[model samples]
Target: MRAVILGGIARRVLDELLRNPYRTIELRSARNVLAVEKAMDEALKLFLTYDPIEDVSTGTEGLLADLIEAKQLEMRVPWEESDEREITVCRAKVKLFGLGRVVEVERRERILVAKVRELFPHEMNMG
Candidate 1:
């Protein structure tokens, strides 16, 4: 359950980060980044070995839904201007801020997409 929530948070964070474009956002949380990274790895692994389940969706979709239902994921990012922001999130703890370097949005998208893709790609009717 933690992994699932972390996956939802990671996707939420990255998606929010990318949408801002040309801004430096500090993602702070009580949950360490290792949990988020582990979630990503596990998500990728699931995509790699997913068994088709009729009328159901797999991968991050379910995670996202749960995050939405649980209200653990913030849909709107807080905007900061002229100064760096320090936010204390209640969901999880994290000391590692992955966006410290401030990469381009395109590159960030590529990195995220690559990270989420299955190790072995195959057509699955997860529904």
Candidate 2:
């Protein structure tokens, strides 16, 4: 299942997004587009490999969605900006084996950071 997803469905999805010239306004500059492409690929890899799910979930889409959002947010940073702009990519709760887990992925200065933590069953009951 994982192989099928990464090799087929996910691959097609990534390819489509990469090929879409109008995907985002931030890709105007070739330099920025290349940077974003690299980041997008990284985001997909992180999503597919993290936890190794047999089927797709919102988490998968969320990571990509958040990455795009991060890029949009990054554009507002002035060219002269020096400080790192930390953007929240994904912070979602996913159920595995009926247990809830939190998936957090963030972007800072074109770098992607991701982490997953198994939630205590009781944690799932909270807000």
Candidate 3:
């Protein structure tokens, strides 16, 4: 069986907000879409480094679904009060076993930050 650890980008954004509340509006702006896209791309790159999935395999699809589900769950149980202007970002950290012992990381984002590692998973020490 495989194991998955889930987390959201909202947490990281929230932390940033706590440190600099003024950026909240800017973070949600449409202009930040590229940043968010880059973040997702980076996340995918990180995932593939450990677990490379091909076109036909359902692994990528399933992993994406799991990541989205995890994000939804995280939203349902917010660590702080929900705000209308606040956006939640979610992602997953997946572990595959058996013949393919690999780890995958996925991330969702609402804003583009120059240095955001909130959704990135730590290096796995286990094999």
User: Which number leads on lDDT?
Assistant: 2
| lDDT string, candidate 3, 1-127, tens digits | 2322112224343334334422322222232333334434544211121222222122231111111111211224354665443454433232221121233332234321221122212332212
The residue-by-residue lDDT of candidate 1 on 31-108, one tens digit each, is 323333444455421111111122122243321111111113333344654253444432432222222111111122
Residue pairs with colliding backbones in model 3 are 9-89
- Name the regions of candidate 2 deviating beyond 4 angstroms: 1-40, 43-107, 110-112
TM-score of 1: 0.20
Pairing residues by index, what is the TM-score of model 2?
0.19
- Candidates in order have lDDT scores of 0.27, 0.32, 0.27
Candidate 3 minimal-lDDT segment of 10 residues = 61-70
Higher-TM-score candidate of 1 and 2:
1
lDDT per residue (tens digit) for residues 1-127 in model 2: 1111110123443344434522322223332334345545654322222223333332433212223333433333444674744432222221112222325544444433444343344554312
